[model samples]
Target: MIAGISVAVAVLAGCGPLPELDGDPTAGKDGGAKSDSETGRGVNPLDNPDGTGPGLKVISSDKDRAKARDLIDKVATKGRGAKTGYDRDEFGYAWADSVDDVPWGRNGCDTRNDLLKRDGRDIKYRSGSNCVIASMTLYDPYTGKTIDWTKSKASEVQIDHVMPLSYDWQMGASRWSESKRKQIANDPLNLIPVDGSTNGSKSDSGPATWLPPRRDIRCSYAVRFAQVALKYDLPVTSADKAAMLEQCA
Candidate 1:
């Protein structure tokens, strides 16, 4: 969680302005970048191997689809475990910045704000703190919509775990160390900013259970899921893996 403005100001006074990014200054608030346009939000998964760039773009070309399939093939498959004892706190507090060994961790900013800064355009920091986001225009890839979000209406936008934490637990994270779990929880490679309701509907489901509402981005979404799983050496269910492959097929 980000500290409130007054509390964060002194600690983050010199944190500096948000990093400069190359994006359209005049893109409409509802559509920050076109789905096919190579400008603001269309970040190819192959190009953004680290998941530090903007929203996932469609993998439309035959060549890119083949690459996505190959990546998906490398992921192992397994049966999901019982969801008997899983809890969010098991991974650490929500968006803790102090988690060791993940990008943007221990950087004086919470994981939520780090993602907001990564995906939101025209971002506005809180009055006296660069670590808290006050408002921004976000291109939500889950539903292919743009949202002008403010801290006041925080739930309108949510940071989604691409491979959700609970799903991770069911697959194999249940046996991992607390530190490794925390790393997966806060890692940018496993996160994406999307519409809150859409994310709620997903609710730890694997690709077989849910996919992005935007048909065009489903293939890219699968590729991202595979990337996160492969990074953590996690496996999806056989059904989930098949559904992921079908998206690109």
Candidate 2:
């Protein structure tokens, strides 16, 4: 028995602090969460395959860009289909965590709160509750701005579907089983918190038609778009793929 000196036990031996990782129900997408530089407000898309990390960081390195290209190249292309009979409700009610079909599901928090906590800085949780976000500073990757957001003006921060549900519908998700559609709708890999106006502008447009206004983040955003597409085996339009590649190029 040792005296007052406390032991510094390691989760793993001879190693530094571990990177936070996410759990996945899907095979092999689970991996370490990568944090960005001093602000620690974002994550690199290349290191966060599971899409559980906060949001995109500027992809400045050529090597990482090439890797992003390789990933993007793997995504198949197809002409987008019709929007007839398309309905948002087909994907599931927004941010319901009623089941364990996807990562962070049924974890005693709704998907919206989970995302806010994941990406927000200086977070203030509601009194006596950790899951309900009362206020936070959000770095909006889409607009190159930081939003001082609070629950009072909730719409100021919008959770965007990287692969929008309507776009997904036109890209063969119209035929997907109901549960699979919900998983894609709420999956962190497909979701991002961005400026409300920017997200609203995006609507259901693909990369060719819309992208983040912040130039440096485009490449990382493309990689995340591809990550979601590949994970769900969803295809982007030929034009969308070209636009995604152009960002990394």
Model 2 — which ten-residue stretch has the worst lDDT? 1-10
Q: Model 2 misses residue 208 by how many Å?
A: 0.5
Top TM-score model: 1
CA lDDT, every model vs. true structure = 0.80, 0.80
- After superposition, candidate 2 runs with Cα above 4 Å error: 1-40
Alpha-carbon TM-score of each model against the true structure = 0.85, 0.84
Put down candidate 2 lDDT per residue, 1-249, tens digits, no spaces: 112212222222113332221121222223443334334348888999887888887788889999999999999999999999899899889898974557799899999998888888899999999799999988776655668899999998999999999999999999999889989988888888877876887778888877776556778889999998999899999999999999899
RMSD of each: 11.1, 13.1
In terms of TM-score, how similar is model 1 to the real structure? 0.85
Residue 90's lDDT in candidate 2: 95
How many steric overlaps does candidate 1 have? 0
